[model samples]
Target: MSKVRGTNTLPEMRVRRALHSMDYRFRLHRPDLPGKPDIVLQKHRVCIFVHGCFWHSHPGCVRATTPESNGEFWAKKLAGNVERDRRSALELAEMGWRVCVIWECETRYTDALVLAVNRCMKHSGPISL
Candidate 1:
């Protein structure tokens, strides 16, 4: 599925639009950050990751369907993705940066996406989990 994107995803673009409309300035994909978060508000010490439901293995999400073929391969692949996400998030947190993970499903719901971003803008915490 090379056609599948790993950057500039649809949900990521939407989040960027919302943040821009709110006058929240941020860096796109800061390489210095763990996992190279989608949007990085350096001034606020906050980073946001717009994760795909299928790629990040969003729990309880219908979009995260396991392939009927190559069952074991898909399972291991998704599991690794999730594990990597956890590790990178932990690393960012331990380094004193606030992290916000916005899943594709959440972004699909306007209210949820808005709420999460607004909270990120206003939150003074280290991480939103």
Candidate 2:
């Protein structure tokens, strides 16, 4: 679980690659921002969070499975993760930043991920929710 240590995960790297190929220069894990977004494009005022489908409890995702044992513990733990994510996104938006979440599942397809990133960057408001 501590393998990624909350940075430089596979999905995050993939997203970074796509963004770079698009010619969008950006910073990574800006500590000053809420949740310390995985990728920060301050020039565009956009914050991208690369969330794991399981850890962030991606709704309707098969990867977000619950453990048969310690049901209560896993439930509470995952719930907390989701709540924290929601709060961070809200905070970023209130601070006038456009927040986008690229889930782990989404990163599996390089073409689709690139298109989604491009589309989100063109939008006016937060595309995270």
Candidate 3:
């Protein structure tokens, strides 16, 4: 678990790279937020979260498997992550912020990832990617 990273993850980096290429600048991990969002666009009232399938327990995700050993611990940990994410998203929404979650599985498909990012960015403004 030591190798597990919570920030600057592969999917996050891919999205960051794509956004940067498009000349879209954003803040990384704003601490003031409830969940410390991975990317923040202050001007657009947007925040992005890059979640791991296993960690966040993505619904219907095959990668989100319960550990055979210490299943209870894993379950508790994963559940907490999910609950925190939900609460944070809710809080951000209540504050008029748009939240986008980029899952680990999404990284396997760059085109889809790009489209998702573009769609979010569309609400902010036109960007060249």
TM per candidate comes to: 0.89, 0.90, 0.88
User: By TM-score, how accurate is candidate 3?
Assistant: 0.88
| Candidate 3, position 6, lDDT | 79
Model 2 lDDT tens row, 12-119: 999998888777899999999999999999899999999999899999999999888999999999999999999999999999999999989888986668666866
Model 1 off-target regions past 4 Å?
Answer: 123-129
The local distance difference test score of each candidate is 0.85, 0.88, 0.85
- As a whole number from 0 to 100, the lDDT of residue 117 in candidate 2 is 87
The true-versus-predicted C-alpha distance at residue 88 of model 1, in Å, is 0.6
Please write out the lDDT profile of model 3 over residues 25-126, one tens digit for every residue.
Answer: 999999998789999988888899988888899899999999999989988999998899999999999999998987888767867777678777664654
Q: Per-residue error at 51 for model 3, in Å?
A: 0.5
Residue 110, model 1: lDDT of 70
> Candidate 3: where is the Cα deviation over 4 Å?
122-129
Per-residue lDDT of model 1, residues 22-126, tens digit only = 778999988878888889989898989998988888888999988999999999999999999999899999999888888888777677777778777774542
